[model samples]
Target chain A: MSPGGEALSRILYVEDDHDVRKVATFALKAVGGFVVEPCESGQQALEKAAGFAPQLLLLDVMMPGMDGPTTLERLRALPAIAGVPAIFMTAKVQPQEVSRYRALGTLDVISKPFDPMTLSATVRAIWAGRDD
Target chain B: MTELMGAEAEMRDALRRLRADGVQRLGERVRELSAGWAALQPRRPWDDADRARLGELAASAHRLAGAGGTFGFPALSKAAAPLELLLLGLRDTPAPGGDRLRQAGAQVAAVAAAWEAGPAGAEEDGADPGQASPAEHGEPIFLFAEAEEQAMLSAVIANLGYSVRRASEREVLEGALPEGPLSAAVIDDAVPDPLAVCARLAGRCPLILLAEDSSFENRLAAARAGVEALVAKPLEVNELADWLDHFAGGRAETRYTIVIVDDDRLLAAAYAMALRQAGMQVTSVSDPAQAIEVIAATAPDLILMDLQMPGIDGIELARVIRQTRRHLSLPILFLSAEQDTERQILARRLGGDDFIPKPVDLDRLVTLVRLRAERARALRAVMESDSLTGLLNHARFKERLGLELERARRHGTTLSLVIFDLDHFKSVNDTHGHLVGDRVIRGLARSLQKRLRRTDVIGRYGGEEFAALMIGTGPEEARGIIDHLRERFAAASFETEGGSFGVTFSAGIAGNAPGGAGPEGGAEAEAMISAADAALYAAKRAGRNRVMVAPA
Candidate 1:
């Protein structure tokens, strides 16, 4: 259970790479014990986010069409998921880039080349760190 | 727990399958990236059409970088990253330098090499990279111990990521000198004539003595011989590693002054603010044309540049900078939206330090910049310092004098310049040998350093003569400080091999000569120095071993 007073069970995961998505979905579901709905690109995530009613928005930074940051901006405009918390997962992010991401009201950024075994624990820690 | 174990077992099997499936795609991706190697010729005309082709290549590399690390090959991602960055940077350049293009080729070659050697890492693709500590120190540590302890000691040090150069204690006693410029040396207490060996290695490198019993007498003897630390025989490897790090970190740490040249004002301002917060002095120049003036005036420790600018690009500006003899070796790091390859090659040839790919992780940038500046500052200190005594050299002292004077005048504050000459110096050298005379000089230099404020610039002006620039102080205050220094030296005991001896100095101080706020040409700097010289002559005539101040 998160500080939001609900169990963080459903995560709307967006990533363009099929291999990464396949492993991450397994990491979130089988290893992490969470119900995961995966989207292949930013466009698909935007289409599915409204109906999923996810506990969190797990977005990838680089995508083919809309990209991570842009998708977050567009998804935020919708009434259903306007105030939902978001986190960015990327390969590398500089300190300044982290500041920029934070200014867009992100919870935290998990770096890529991340160990799949510890993926869920990282997300749980992020959840625990936030008070509200 | 059993339920979790079942899930974990399934996860590993899934990981193995992911690697088997992704390995084919990894090979194809590297092949695609390598396909455009011929098009990256440095001599070829770089225009809009070439840029389009390079963009396509960069997109491919970018995809590979994001995907490979997640699959079986993290090395594949690491290798493709630099090439992708270089291509992305080069595509934006209107006329990229030849050297930068060559750098891109090298990165591409590296990608090919990484792919060849990548399968070894892929076997355990799901393993965590965070467990490894990056502990590779460049300088080798010197070891002088018993032959029995050599293997165990070297293994422990090597595991901590240091290369150890070992020597037997018997070899040293036989006068077989260890090759050094070594950072630190570890010696054993069991060694014969350990004090003699310690004396030789003391000032050259940090000495850590490994004591068999670790007694009080051993500590005292180690301290007397100038060993930095004495480690007990049953080694606390962690504690030993800490001491090594502490000594190595004690290099001249100066506050680096940096200039950021970019067209983006907001970006430059952000970086400047960040650097300032990190205890650095930073200046940001938005206009490329005005950047040259700023760079010249500041003579900054480092320059952070952008490859693409409006008036003149970073390459042309770097060329202009390299043309100047003084700034030829100044460290310049390129920070741009798309960083690397053609621009990198060109920048390296022009003596640029590194290409920090953007959007840069600020922590890495700060650390790298600090490391580069620390090395530059340390080298500059060696150049500016007097060899015999670590005070500023004669020429550097005078240069500091002018700068301090101008700064004091600008701030509407007082500054004092004092010269100290050892009295009866020729007679002392005649009575004692030249070595004792040199010891006396070093003794005076040490006393001055101990007594004077850190802000005061002290220098060995000549043989047996020293000068100090004391800012924000009046003549009366300056005279009081020097008077204390004079009495301290006259009474203080200086023990040498030739036996105990004492020395005194005559000091002349000049201050507030450039007084009053007259905007246009109030006082000349030459008059102030002349006044100090006259006062010194007066001190010599009246009596030596006293402090005197010139009339304002």
Candidate 2:
């Protein structure tokens, strides 16, 4: 996927809810036309992170086991996941929460109750400005 | 393209099915919340197990809030938010209470009520990924305070007709996206390192420092923190509301009316379109013969007249308009190819406010019209205030009613017109001198100013009748406010040279919201005034000194 490096092609997505993961898969794969690895828990993400290298990280902030930030921390230990741009999606969009996520090395926080229709485009937008 | 369409269609189909599932899930959550509220012990000490159970309930509410919000049921989501917050607060503390707990039940009931209200604007946006969200959930006002203060402050802001999103206690935000596009932020002065925190938050939103004393040092520090406004700690709601309104920006601009009097139909149409697009109500007079009639009917803020015409020139027409005392100060800009310096000078000397060359740029024309009309409206506002009450005089009051009604129609907001006639004022003058009656009127005016917001328009409609225009206020709310005013007025005793005398005035309120059906028969200000007048008549018939709402 990185051979044509100019275009973003893969995303590592971790969310706790099955329904949300399904919707996200459709949005990121079918609509966005990008390869996606949708993990139901941060533990699953840790297990798969090294094998399925991704250009971006899309993680749900609140999860059943090992929430988004902790998951991202663990993922950074994997050699394949180094310096990958990450985004947090959560209903906790208070300014402090956004800042906390940013300080944790995420690109930005996508407010939960996010329009799934715009999810793909939002992902691409974050990836487009990665260098900035 | 075919493949793309196929995939898109499948996506839409999937979204439709998911939305249905989301609705069912939401219904389940509402039931779960109701059950959770029912399970709560009002007076019992909350144990760890109880707290955990309540935490699950809060989680349910949080899920419902997020799902409802995303599934196009914002009202339900908004109603669920407070419940979730309340539960969070309760779960954190051991103190058990009945009232706030009951209030949590009430919040659940509201969520159920909103869910019963059903989904609005759901189907259309199914396939339209880029469809803008309905402004039903306008950018909420962020209450950046401790959890203790947040609930109280959130209630206050919500009562002002704005939705509220609050920060958890001990929240520290250094960079962007606090509550997602905050209309304004209220900073608790007790927050440690408050000044530095505010400085970090400066450009994110308009920061309002809620402080005990606006001492010079604090004020200086506040300025450095880029606080746009301040509210004294003793939190006067009216002052807080006023500051919030000031910072909310987009305070519904003055929609100035313009009269375009041109002989050439095409040029007149062009000017009218330009001005109308720029939000000025434009009246085009292609036949300059009826210019006065149109201008009088429109009562325009400014006139754009053509300098050259076959029968009468722009200067000639303006000369005629200036002859009328009422139209004397009305700004008139003349459009003419007759660019002779002498003609321009002549036009300026005789009632012409400005000279526009024949081919005027539409953008420049719009800017000029806006600037001129704004000045005219300001001047007119001064000229329009009643000498006796410092409210708008009858004619100007009527004009503003029309303007405000137009605005209400445009913005889909609410407007209420109140007509107050002092009961048996002739008798008051007979009993006490006319000076006493005048004092009575002045007294009522002061009472109105005291009770109503500064944004509300008050006018001396007649010698003894007063009118008030309330913007963005619904009928029931208007009635409540005015009824309170009516009580205050009746209670007030005006002390004169001889003795103090009490007076009472009857008030009738008529209000309209876009798509709202009521006694405001026609959306026109004339109809509203008459409706209010009829209600006032009914009040007088029933017996005086009562506030009556116009009936549907």
Candidate 3:
């Protein structure tokens, strides 16, 4: 297998439980060979402004404590991140809500229970299509 | 190499164990502190001595806060926040300067002590959060850094039923010095430069600064900065709380002084007591000869004058007052045991606002005094208001017009003037009674008031004539509004004792003219009014009940 250097370019992964930080950790490091940071709260991801800081920031918008909009405000405060794209991974993403999230400063939001097999490749394609 | 690696791994494991143990201990300490703090409640019946003892108690609590969090007892440190703030405040403002501080300390201490006594204290002092009103607890706090310190302070104060917040560094001085309803602020003088902080905070809030040592210069500077006082550090929290309580409490009700110009000593004293009970400041003067001196000095809101006194009768005194010109509008209530209606009417004609019969009903007398005082304030407002048409009077109008003209000229806009007069108003007063004439004038004023926009001002210019200022309105719109008013006045009817009769008025509208327009069109607003007046006179001459438009 090709050194997996190209596979490390983008990542899309989801886990509802915070206790399993190691599961996403192994997938990012060994399988996808992607740089990854694990977070317990959607609030932390927004605070970090991963969208502007890196090539991608996969979000679980319906996390406990601070919900999506609040995280969005914190992310928006970062001036460098203007229109740096975002995507929400939710278990219940209706087509209407997907458009709503897209309207709310997101490029695309994927439905949850996404196949781990194709996750990294799918995320890479999405990133490649981004104008920014 | 393998042996060295094993040693490094063992050292790392040891460090992890220490961190874990430290976190657990911190969590336990926080729980204990929270439990201890939740027990605090304010207690009553605290004397001055109890308030003074609060300083020592606060010092101990301050030490606890400084040590508890550092020792991994975050909860205990957190619990000490309000106590630390209170203690620091008390320590900085000891003795006579913070008498209220002592009372507040006594209350906090009593509650804290009661809480320490366990379940019984909790049952007795348990705060019904629902019962606690925002008024007592809405003491705003300025946020500062030191998350644990702020949290502890907020918790302790919150338990005491005060709303608390972390003050920003920039706002710390302002937070310490409250402008409006704040009782007091516990200010730390150790921040970078203490004197500068004191000066900034003192500008707004009454600052009770934490003094490290007794320096006379520091005290003098604090006083100059409007700081209430400085209490040396190693604080007594209770005494500071007491000081906050007193100053933060409602101010005493306002008292009015009534100087009685009656000569009977017993009666004067009786009236004085009655007025005092009615919450007024009373000065009794039995000698009418000293009336002017007493009146000028005391300046009571109302004067109760005794008619048929030993030296001067009430009517003559009333006339003297009217003659003073300064006291022309002063309400003089005549106190006459004299039971004659003719005398009462004569007293009123002589400028007595009211007549209190002999054997005055204490209640009626009190009611009359309050009524007169209120009316006096109203009259003062009215003296600045136009008397005839109930708009701003001439003096106020001139000031407003000048200001408006300056603003309009600055912005390069037009200000217009309109002058109105009743056509043959002299005939109305002459043919009909003056009462009927007054009704017609009032009717015209009401009609103008309703037809014009709210921004327009209408003031009676002497008798049967009025003036109006229309801001930002051009000559066309001003004339349109004036014409509408004239038409409305022509259609309106005035009711008199005899019968109702139709009334009419003539108006002239003029706008701000260019500098070289004419003598009548100069930049001076008076020119505009005069130009409008000229057109108004022309309208009257031309015919009755018509609009006369002046050239811009």
Candidate 4:
């Protein structure tokens, strides 16, 4: 189940780093069996959001030009990804900072230096625990 | 259990295949990141550009730290985490000092070297992945030589995977300089009048000269021609290719200092650990009374202080710091658990730049500190740096000289100064207009800034004149460095309306060498300056574009 209490299949992951995006895509696809569409930046996420019609948004927090929280805010303005839950991935997440991410309407904050092995499982847990 | 064991085995095999395919590329990425980090190293005091670059480095390192751990290089991740933290803290503030930057750079270098070494079995045969292939990043190497020579060299360069662009000396001189950024340039010394061609391209890219003769005269000519490396002909193609690869791979790095003050030892340690992990040189003071002394000694770019202490509170401490003329503009950030709006407002009024509540979120704290520190640094740059050349201004230069001189005397170390004045600078201004003159000055400033070691203090002492304070350097070593720079400047061509022209400077070195008469106080600084000036006159009298050392 998705964080929105729906079956999560398609994930729109927005991360600027090419390597991180590649590894995350491998985890979600090969391990979790989810269809993952990756965007390099917030602007790219917006341009591809509607066409891809992703069920979840996995956004990196510290990106050049436009960051994750700003991306989510812009995406919320659009009808396509509006109310679609996002989970922020950032090295900056302290416990209080995680609360700030949650207040931004994200499903949760996944601190960076994350284990690739359990990443897919962690996302699934967050999905299952989502109130909506 | 048997079925599960079989499934786990299958997964392990798949993971191994993935790693084998991916690790090489990941290693390359790490090297690229390291090079980028190196390129961002601040040559001077932190400015707007340096701050922006710091932010970029932090963001990139943050990504690497996360991805590196996930991909089985836990060591790489561990190495990058501190860099990320350090950059985040330094992103907004002026860098702390050169020593701090060096420490941070060493940390990054360690990580980069580790990645280049790679993990056992990650590679097919333990070959250094960095040397495996030339970067296929679409950047082309420009070859400036005769037609026949170009044919032989282009093939070797191209074989290494770099795109090669060929141009003859005549083509380059006729204003057919390549349109894009070049990876490197190869020039055959047989070309007629190659100095002019080489001079134009000197600092633009790395230039390697292929010479038929290795005679002293021929090598001297090549040096005068502004090429970085001169190859005696019958060029070993493999060696040339390796040199090209090495030239293409260089990048930058920098470090910052932070001072953390809190009455709670454990809390102070926590903050210090976080900052240090980011590769920052951190000084923590748990006793409020010691804060002033530590701050004075460190002269840190940012002060992270807790609000409440036994003897003196953060607000009062900040006020005391502000009262001191030297640190009046220093950024003071309060990290406290106090939630009272009135008290926070009072702290702000007493010169607190920012306030973070207690049990501070480490990430947020770092970001906040960096922003505040960077802003303070940029403001300092405006007051401290010359508007035209971006070096230290005359006043700041003298001020810093006094400080360095005093420090050298206390430590019983040598301090050398080089005073340089451009030759025929007035004529250039008259003939080519002031704009071109300004360009020449700026070019020389950039050259000196780039070429000198980070410890050297450079300043625009006067119009068409510059001075550098080489700490821990004697007169002879200072002269050698100055002479090298003179040669480089003489080979550099400045663009003018009349076409490009070369400019050179005459320099004089004066130092308080060991067992020599040294400056006793600020008054004697003027005498030392005069000595250098006298030697400079001697250089101009003997010949322009040369260096002279003051007699003991």
Candidate 5:
């Protein structure tokens, strides 16, 4: 959902694990009340990105075909959604890796084993405070 | 709060449903994959087809390992990890005997069986479903206190989000020490011969002493016992919490990179494994000739080099590294079996920061390496940082810019630079005096530091002007970020003696994206700086408080 007037509505989530995708999608839809289009792989994400017109890209770092950073690079090359903000979901998010992901222009990183109940709230907080 | 509870309930219900669905799907997949694996089982000598089959098994195992954990089947995940590793190894070598293949196949079948049998079977196999062990979480703090004090201290530490173990007796403490690596140890004064106990546990974990004695003798004894901190009782929970916070924040999980160089492979491996167990990223080099290459690639925080090697000695290697301008201040530690005092002195003279003898006590070695590396890092920060703003100084900034440009060229990535000058900074100084002007400058520095990503290196280029190196950012994105920073800075008010006033800045951005003109050397860095400077001037000419991107 759009936090204030920024219209951070459409979120394209790319995760490999079907179970995680299912639970997280339920959280975003029922708890977060946002329109979420979940993709199983980075390639599928790239194929659907322009058509979905998501305001934000929630990507998984380690995917099978075209990992999150490479996918972000390709997405940035496309004229549509070139400047959209992106966030990464990763399991092994060390301090150095977090900085590296940020260098790739991600707005933030959400570590894995995330709380399903609070996941939507966390996303909303990041979106609301992005201007800072 | 009620809405949040409702949402939580909803999420929990959804997760329960998903877990059920996932378990069923996992059982089906495991059965199919295990059947495929059993059919491919080698009866006699392994061949290419068997190797290919092993690859398939490994890939499926990898997927299972990842999915099992996510789907609330941690037992399956745990069983699959070693199997995956085993299969991958077999795929690589394929020469493992029939026994090895049999063991791998049995392990795969066990995992499949575990999945099929569901929760009851996993519990029967002694696998905890959702709970992770303490070691899997993080290193725990060990507290040695009197029986009366133990409960209070442990409760306080546990409340502070630390996994703590309490022991009142020496035997119990000694047994607990081997359970896992400790983050830190705290001892109460009531413990008999506390100094001796502290000395015994000193290098193993950072030790803190809580003593009632404030005498100089006791303080001196505690210092000699290698205690990092001594708190005079009665210890406040808040004070102990503060100390624990510092210890946890500075734990080795920060992943300080270390490079160990020794011609002796076994010795090097031992040192590497010990350091790695302590949470340092360690790379070992057996050949001194490859020392420079490894150092360049890893950018290690410390170098542990053996003094005596066959061809190039540690002294020569250290000298070679010192010859490189970038690594001049990097700490080089000498580890040697030689007992010659003269050689140790020579090694220190030739750029060795510290000397440790061979057959190093593992605990002492880890402590010394951590201390020296942290000290070197602090010294470097002081030397390279600006005094007023704490950003990189001009000279250090330029040096890093050159290095980052070289890296970007080699990696075929983009590097962008943003230069921002405070608009009418002279007028601010003229109106509010230099003291307030300094405050305004510091204010902008703080904002930049807070707003920019950690990977973006911000530096005070000169008086009232700041620059940032945005690695992997393009011209347009850099402009957007800088423009946002500019707008925020314009809106921020600064307090002065007279009243409050707002400050704004103009910025210029230049990026070298991939497939564009590649930056070669220091000259390219200089060109980028000049281009950004030219664009900054344009922004100033077009009325300040705006951002401009340098034309490609």
Candidate 6:
């Protein structure tokens, strides 16, 4: 049932919200054409970093346990997550703020209240932007 | 999920009861007012005797208008709005007809009747029942203070827009500053120790230190604690409001960048050092051309530019900076040796905060820069730049002055305002090339600054004019200081393009004395300037180059 664009190109999705995870999990499986793994917290993501071996990480900025930025900082410390293409999802995506996040090594930010239809395509686009 | 549902149900039930309580309270007040009106014994509903009764009814109507919304009876509240308007109309109408009286009376009565019915029709009325209620269930402000002094202190903090929750009486920290997004938080120097609180909210919120005692040790302690600012006791509420506004606007409150553009390496280094001493994050550029690019990347809080540059002049740099968004509100204070009113006015008009005529008055320049940064952070909503010296922008000064005012109001402290002006700044500019003339002005800033207390505030008010606020000082003492500054400035030997020149300044001093009003609808600090301005003018009229004390 897969388009078979890429296999085992690990995807790590960190979100505190369960409903968002449920919706995203389905979209990634059906449309993303890649392996998808979901984690609830930055700490949890850090713990599963070795085994999951994600090529790309999608992180939610605002969360209860360890925020996205802090999580990214910790991830940068780990050699496995180093140089991994990262994207942030946040409510604040103003030009100046986005630039700051970009300066911190984030390739792009997918704004919150994201489109359920376009989530997979956007991630694919970010992945492409990195190669170029 | 079940637990969450239970919590929602509890909230819904609490809101329902609150509505019922609001309605009952409104009904009781209305009935009590009605009885009072009946006892007044009016001859006719339209007569002058009914004036107090109408007033009482209007008061009840006003109360219901606010109260009704609490219970989700928004329509009842909206219906009561007309009564306020009608009552206003009646107050102006000398002889009102029975129709007006009957309408007002009926409206008030109907509001009371509606509330008495409880929150029955609230849902059907197209109002979000929950929207009409307070965010939290009635939680009376509690402060954990063993002593009355501490309690009073807590009251002051509570009044300043903090939800001070009392933890335990033994707890040194009063209440935990709610762990939510806060614009800014106030940490006292001693009790409710700010170190832990600042650490908790660090990088999340800007922290302001309220200094109970203005001692070197205290200030050092505050600085080590990583506080954004140290606002001494007798703080200004306006200043606090400014800090809050800066944070609320989501501007960087942690560190501010000041761009110094100069052709002279030595001079640039000196100015940068002075700015750093004032605690500003400084970026110094030896060339004027780099001002645009440097400012573009990281928008600085303020800019200090050398008037004379090798390629593009300081004025041109100022114009270019004005064109850039990063420098839009960026105060560009010219570090020039240009002293003409027309030239200074030109720089000011080009969006320059103020021009520090060189050989930069190190102390005054530093103080002015700090004040300007504070003002920029505080009054992001208002105009910037001081009128004289064209330094310490207005919005920035207002924020600092506001903090000073709030502190004064809280701590029962005295703040003095001193206004001083160059006795013949115009003639000097005319006689000497505005270049040499500017050196004299900068030199004067240095002299005057030397005469001030370390805590005193001095800013260039406008052309040949300056204002100083001496905290915890009286008018007499302020007058003495101002008079001394004037004498020293007059005696200074200023070397210019032509030759050495001597200059004199005139000053006026006023205190925020009891029953005192700010002159010209500004503020206490401003009023003091007005009094001082008037005194300065008087001194000029009495013959230039003398100091005049504001009339007691």
CA error at residue B461 for candidate 2, angstroms? 6.9
- Name the regions of candidate 3 deviating beyond 4 angstroms: A1-132, B1-380, B514-523
lDDT of 4 by residue, B1-552 (tens): 999788778765776666555566667667776877767754456678767777777666676666665566655665566666666555544536433454456556756865765553443221211111123234468888777877878886776566787885568557356543466888777776666678888866788877778799877876887888877666645346546756764321123568888765545655665665444567888887787889878889899998887788788889988887878888888977677999989999989988886555555676787787768778888999999987999999998888888788778889888899999999999989887778788878867876788889999999999999998999999888889888977986664445678899999888874643554788667877888999999999998889999997
Ranking by lDDT: 5, 2, 4, 1, 6, 3
Model 4 chain A lowest lDDT segment of ten: A1-10
> TM-score of chain A for each candidate?
0.94, 0.92, 0.72, 0.93, 0.94, 0.89
Q: For every candidate, give the share of true A-B contacts it also has.
A: 0.29, 0.17, 0.00, 0.31, 0.14, 0.00
Summarize candidate 1's per-residue lDDT along B382-495 as a digit string, tens digits.
Answer: 878998887999888877776677777777788888988999999889988787788788778866875788789899989988988888888889999999889978985555
lDDT of each: 0.74, 0.75, 0.57, 0.74, 0.76, 0.62
Candidate 3, residue B536: the lDDT equals 86
lDDT of 4 by residue, A27-84 (tens): 7887777999999999999999999988899999988899999999998898988978
TM-score, one value per model: 0.47, 0.44, 0.30, 0.49, 0.46, 0.27
Model 6 lDDT on a 0 to 1 scale? 0.62
Model 1 residue runs over 4 Å out of place are A1-9, A91-96, B1-7, B36-53, B72-75, B89-103, B119-552
DockQ for every prediction shown: 0.16, 0.09, 0.01, 0.12, 0.09, 0.01
Preferred candidate (TM-score higher): 5 or 6: 5
lDDT at B548 for candidate 1? 86
Give the distance in Å from residue A70's predicted Cα in candidate 3 to where it truly belongs. 12
Give the number of the best model, judged by DockQ.
1
> Distance (Å) between predicted and true CA of A32, model 5?
31
Better of 3 and 4 by DockQ: 4
* lDDT (Cα, tens digit) per residue for candidate 3, span B209-321: 66676589878887886668676654333334334433332222134568898875544554554465345777888889888878877756789988878768888887887
Question: How much is B13 displaced in model 4, in angstroms?
Answer: 18
Q: Give DockQ: model 6.
A: 0.01
